[model samples]
Target chain A: MLLAIAQPLAWFLGFDSLMEFIAFVIAAAVAYQALKGYRLSKERTLLYLHFSFVLIGAGLLVDGLSSIVVLLSQFHRGFVVLYALGYTINFIAQLIAYGLLVFAYLQQTRNISAQFAATAVVSALFFERNAFAELILIFLLVYITAHTAMNYSVSKATNSMLVFGAFASLTIAHFFFLMFILVPIFFPLAHIAQLLGFLLLLGMLLRVNQPS
Target chain B: MIPGEPGSSTKPVSKYRSQFRIYVDVMQVIQREKNQAKPTRILYGANLSHDRLIKYLEELKSLGVIQESGTEDKVYSLTQKGIEFMNNFKKVESFASAFGFRI
Candidate 1:
């Protein structure tokens, strides 16, 4: 497929990091398209799902750009401060994306009130500097865990493999980050995970389209 | 048959009313298709029966929610009105969610 070819071509062109960023942009486009589709369908659950995807895509795009900059050059001491600030912003964006996803899932399950409260709390907590990152990560872990559980609860849903793949990829990426080995490794792995996730989701979409 | 007229019987008015209602419902479905811009895969995620789906599809095609893409197993997509309706539906959903109503 075009996507499969695009991935390696980006690397060969000395824009490996940029490829990941481009993937984020692609995701954003897909999300936007899906949002429009959901709107046309008048499907509330699908709308929220696409909205969540849009936020996630935006976060990934920001993270991708930051990684690209880091990969291309070393930052000076003063630049390090700027980079740190940027990292904080990126982290906050990611947290917001995760929060939106939680809300989307809750809406799908018809648990609107709980989702609303959770979103507000998560958003508020994201602003607190002390322990903010750790808190957000904790919340993200909880959300992912809960999402997996909910997915399991729905027997008719398809393409769970994609979900598992994404989770596994993220887990490995985070593990590497914790070890402080090479930060660049995380970006590529995350992209791989996202790519797999999207493919899996596409499969699910096709399944839904299948005739009974 | 008209029961009271020359040994003929007729269907009740209620039956006619029900039929009219169904016709209106089908028209709404058709209108939904007419408004979409692209051929969209209409997934009956709610698992409607084949008979019901066929009826809905027929109505939608008539209303232009969908159109025959080609000679192949004609694919269907949404028209502009369909898209607008969908967006409105999403707005309602968003509003409900804002109120913690769970869609």
Candidate 2:
């Protein structure tokens, strides 16, 4: 794993796990909000949103746990495989989660068939400790960002703007992750950007639940 | 259930309104009319046919979300339960709308 060199950066390992944990909590909150909306309105789109965030939360939990395991083992050679496994699982989870989100958007736009095509291609790619997986995630986030951006443009609502900012930040974070291959320093930067993205989502959730 | 787009116009948006949504719509109309909505007002406000309006109004009353008053003209008003439900629904709707999902 390129991030295997994350050893010298070991001091930052615990922080990365903490960040992932925070992201997981925020994702779960978003999922719960979506579920509440689904129950009230019986909207299938809200159900999709619920499932997407559930997957995201699950992925973060797994990644954070594996990071803790690796850190506790003091980078033992036997436990090194856990890092790869965790990354692979996390990557796959985010891929499906984001893919489902894109489907929800496309379904709203009456573009159902495209989801199937994208899914078939994505399943074939699977997970790898390479740029391909990250690229796929970046692609999905970009689509979601564009959709939220269009929504913000139309509604001119603060909540919509927050969502657009969240996805946009996530997309940039993944780009930094992809660049981490060349510049090792990009690792912590990627995690920081990703945390910022999740924080934006938490802000949106809080604002939505505020009394009006 | 088919998920309708937020602002789509290909078909009647009301067709996609679920039972819960209808309930909310009816309650919103009553609230909008200063909590003293007439049958005709709700019929148009909720964009429901006369028959459906009566059916939903009856359901809302049975659920204790609304009450009917007046002997001659007849007026509808939201109960405390209905008011709270609408308040919570507003929050959920805002949350969903943030992500461009219509509920």
TM-score for every candidate vs. truth? Answer: 0.52, 0.91
Native-contact recovery for every candidate? 0.00, 0.61
- Candidate 1's C-alpha runs over 4 A off are A1-16, A70-73, A112-124, A127-132, A149-153, A156-158, A175-212, B1-62, B65-103
Any idea what lDDT model 2 has?
A: 0.84
**What tens digits encode model 1's per-residue C-alpha lDDT throughout B1-103?**
0001111114432233232233333334444556332223243431345676567566655765445465646555556654454444444333333222232
Residue A54 lDDT, candidate 1, scale 0-100: 72
lDDT of 1 by residue, A20-90 (tens): 46556655654664565444444454465566667666665665565445434443344444444544565
Which clashing pairs does model 2 show? none
Question: What lDDT score goes with residue B21 in model 2?
Answer: 73
Using Cα atoms, each model's DockQ against the true complex is: 0.04, 0.46
Give me the candidate number with maximum TM-score: 2
Give the CAPRI rating of model 1.
incorrect
What is the lDDT, from 0 to 100, of the residue A24 in candidate 2?
A: 98
